[model samples]
Target: MRKLETRTIVVASHNAGKITEIADLIAPFGFAAKSAAELAFDEPDETGTTFEENAAIKALASAKASGLPALSDDSGLMIDALNGAPGVYTANWAERDDGTRDFAMAMEKVQKALQEQGAEKPQERTARFVSVLCLAWPDGHTEFFRGEVEGTIAWPPRGTAGFGYDPIFQPEGHKRTFGEMTAHEKHGWKPGETQALSHRARAFKQFVETCLEG
Candidate 1:
């Protein structure tokens, strides 16, 4: 098989965090990843019902508009205690309130629901972060991959390294929250690079290997 050319691949999102993750993941694969904002592409509505569909929609929109191969991802945190709430709606769930309140709200909702059920919080409040990536070409065809990392939610938040709910999320086998690590520190992958295990990283890694470089 021919190697992927060193062409530009546009990532379909305005979020700096997502763009950074995609750029890092695709950089080693010889693709010069750029964000939609860099290309001046308008944001496409993510009206799809599932993460995969949303990713596809965004990918196609960006690919067609930018006239280049495009990658898009939709990711979220799903707490089993909340019956997988804030799944696809992760961003919007926090839209009406301060970003800092999201985790607290999630925790309160879970606790309240548990109380209503007369069931105590499970010893292990299992939760998982899920990421779905879609790669689209101008021809309208698309490829997809998914990844997940399971963990538990910590109360009152933790360090301030990451954005969003990172302060309250603790991956299994790790004592530090995502918010506690710097961007480089999280991606460093020394003894405690939690970002390497994130859903986005895992999914992008798979996409890079199987779709971009394989």
Candidate 2:
């Protein structure tokens, strides 16, 4: 098993929320995680068609630019009723005329589209959030991990704790939406807690087991 030699790792993303989540996950491993924005690394264009490809692209770009190991993730909500639409274009779906992505608007668009498809019942609105994480070394070696959480879309959106589609996503076996859960509840501060059920959390767990833990 290979272990990281550096005390710092770059999180190749401009999203503050993503960086925070990743940093928290990796904090216990005795590594300092810095965001690309904090390091002044230019954001790379994600031209890949799949989550894994995009994650690798970003991770590699940051690693090459910063001369440090970097981590990146690409995630989206995949609605079964929509035939997995807006998969790679999840953020794009929320782009406004001003070119800013509004997740609330995006969630509304998803609901409207489902209604158009005659998916009136909660059972028909089945969906899952998929996340892919890639860790790229400055030497160009990379490792990938993926995670998913099944859920149903809730109407009128609920909660305000989480970002993006959290308000609308009610994880299986949970009565409350993800947006309702605190950071600790969503990510599981304690062991043996199945309640920590975010897609990003799941992916990070895999990375820890496969790459960080020997």
Best by TM-score: 2
For model 2, how does the per-residue alpha-carbon lDDT over 1-214 read when each residue is reduced to its tens digit? 3566777889999987788888877777788777899988887888999999999999999999889999899999999999997788898898899977799999999999999999989899999999999999988899998989999999989999878888999998889898899887777543344444788888887877777666
Cα distance off (Å), candidate 1, residue 211: 1.8
Candidate 2: list runs displaced more than 4 Å. 189-196
lDDT of 1 by residue, 23-135 (tens): 76666546767788988888888898889989998999999997888889998888776678778977775554444335456545554654565544434466888999888
Predicted candidate 1: what Cα RMSD to the true structure? 4.0
Candidate 1: Cα lDDT at 208: 59
TM-score for candidate 1: 0.82
Displacement of the residue 213 alpha carbon in candidate 1, Å: 3.1
Winning candidate number (lDDT): 2
- Tell how far residue 4 is off in model 2, in angstroms: 2.3
- Cα deviation at 189, candidate 2, in Å, is 5.8
